[model samples]
Target chain A: MLKNLLLNRNLTCLFFILIISSFEKIHAQNAQVINFNSLQKIYSNKSDTTYFIHFFASWCLPCLNELPDFVSFSDQHKNEKVKMIFVSLDMKKDSIKTLPQLIEKFKINVPVFLLDETNADKWINMVDKKWSGSIPATLILNNEKKYKKFFSESMSLQTLNKLVK
Target chain B: MIKNIFDFSLLVAICVLSLGFSIKGNKSSYDFHLKNVGGNFVSLKDYPSAKGFIIVFTCNHCPFAKLYPERLNGLNSKYKNLGVPLIAICSSDTITYAEDSFLKMIEKAKNENFNFPYLCDGEQLAAKNFGAQKTPHAFILWKEKNNWTIKYSGAIDDNGAEPDKVQHHYVSDAVDELLKSKKVSIPETKSIGCQIHFRK
Candidate 1:
């Protein structure tokens, strides 16, 4: 009986380890690193669904303050045709650690992506000519409706709801 | 009733002040009398022998601005004798970012051993006048007919993360061209950094 109990305890430990590792894997897999081309593809998709792309950085205080609202908005509209995506503009050197840490800390369940590109001058105009390369900026795009709007400031949940539809 | 009148007068004063400095290049000259980190008020007019100025909008809290201190120091040393002294201003809203408070700015300047004068735009008047959008935003103003003309505006260099890999020295190159009486080849550029939000 003693031998059986010891084996069972070891097996339980192994099972817990597996669960934790897979949990981490899922967390990491949720956020992907994408280039500007991939971002263009995402915005260019001509579908009935509206895509809300929020551009932010870990170091930007205002962006952090508004993240939870965006996440909650995404949660409330999970079944709707509105798709929320977060794209981080954090520096490449620190994004690997900081991006995931921010994701986990914020309990953000929506799909996240790290924008992997340099020379913002080249692509910033492409994203939005009005965007002054500021954080907490959001882009709402729906190719089917031919509707696009960009805001370079932190927004409220009420504002998000009003604008998404 | 008296408070409302006072508010209206204040708004009028702000409008008049903002109109003094135009964002467009060669439109108007801008002047600022801001407090320096050295516990004294300094202005562009203080430098009587200056040919122009390199005014940078920066703050202590922004990580991107932190990376450019050494580069700014280098630029100041390289161009100070050339009659274009570099002046850095911290115009970040202290209410939002305590790290960017005037006291913290003094501490940062001291800790960094900054050779150039770090000024405080307490009201963010200078930032609004220059239409500065982000931290580490650079502007090169040249002395033309006794007025400061904005010849170049934008990032300090091409690379913010890796200074060694910098391909274009936008600010300095503009300064060099201005000194030689030539037009700036690349007058404007954009950078990725923390935005400077206006105080409510």
Candidate 2:
């Protein structure tokens, strides 16, 4: 009986270890590192799904303040056709740690990506001619509706909802 | 393929046109007499011997701006004797961010041992006049025919986080070229930084 109990405890520990490792793998897979070309594809996606891509960095204070709103908005609109995507503009060197921590801290369930690009001068214009490479910028696009817009400042939950509708 | 090429050219034309418009738009006013941290107003006119100015829109609260105090000190120490002096301005709304208050700016300047004048744009007139979009945004103004003409604008350098690893010293290179009576090679470049809190 004592031997059986010990074996059972060991098996339970192994099962938990497997579960935790798998969770880590899933978390790692969710946060993709993308480039400027991939970003253009997302905005220019010819689909019915409305894409709301928010650009932010970990060091930007205002971006940090408004991140929870985006998270909550995504949570409330999970059943809708609108898809919320979070993109981190954090430096590529720290991206591996920054993005995953951001996902965990915010409990973000939607797709998350890191924009792995240097030279903001080149890509800022491609993203939006009006964007001055400031953090907390957002892009909303829907090919079916033929609607596309960009905001270069912090946004509120109410504003996000209104813009999507 | 021909149609795609035509469309690409059209897009490029529009981009160039818009870029021209923006470059011209920010040159409305180049003179400012804003209060410095030493409780006195300072302006380009004060530095009559100055051939140009390195005006950086910066503040106490921004993390990005915080990275550049030492860099700014270095730039000033290098260029001040060469007829170009560095001047930093805090044009962020004091109401929104109390950390950017003039008192705090003075404290920050003193603590950082600023080698140049740190001005407070209390009413944001200088920022609006200069069309400053974000903190740590740099502009190199060259005196042309007795008028301050904007010669270079944008990031101080390519890498803000790691100064030692910087490949492109945009501001310094432009200043050097201007000093040598040559046109700036790369006049403008974009930088990632905190947006200046403009009051609505």
True contacts kept of each: 0.65, 0.72
Predicted candidate 1 versus true structure: per-residue lDDT over A33-149, tens digit per residue:
899888889878989889999999999999999999998999999999999999988887787678778888888888898888767777888889877787889999989999999
Tell me the tens digit of each residue's lDDT in model 1 across B8-122.
9999999877776444532354789999999999989999999989999999999889889999999999999999999999999888889998889999999999999999998
lDDT value, residue A144 of candidate 1: 95
Q: Model 2: per-residue lDDT, tens digit, A44-141?
A: 87888888989998877789899999999999889988889888877666666677777899898988888776567768888788788888899888
DockQ of 1: 0.55
Q: What lDDT score is found at residue A63 in candidate 2?
A: 91
Q: How accurate is candidate 2 locally (lDDT)?
A: 0.88
Error of 1 at B111 (Å): 1.7
TM-score of each: 0.86, 0.78
lDDT of 1 at B21: 49
Interface RMSD of each: 1.0, 1.8
* Candidate 1 chain A least-lDDT 10 residues: A23-32
Question: Candidates' lDDT values, in order?
Answer: 0.89, 0.88
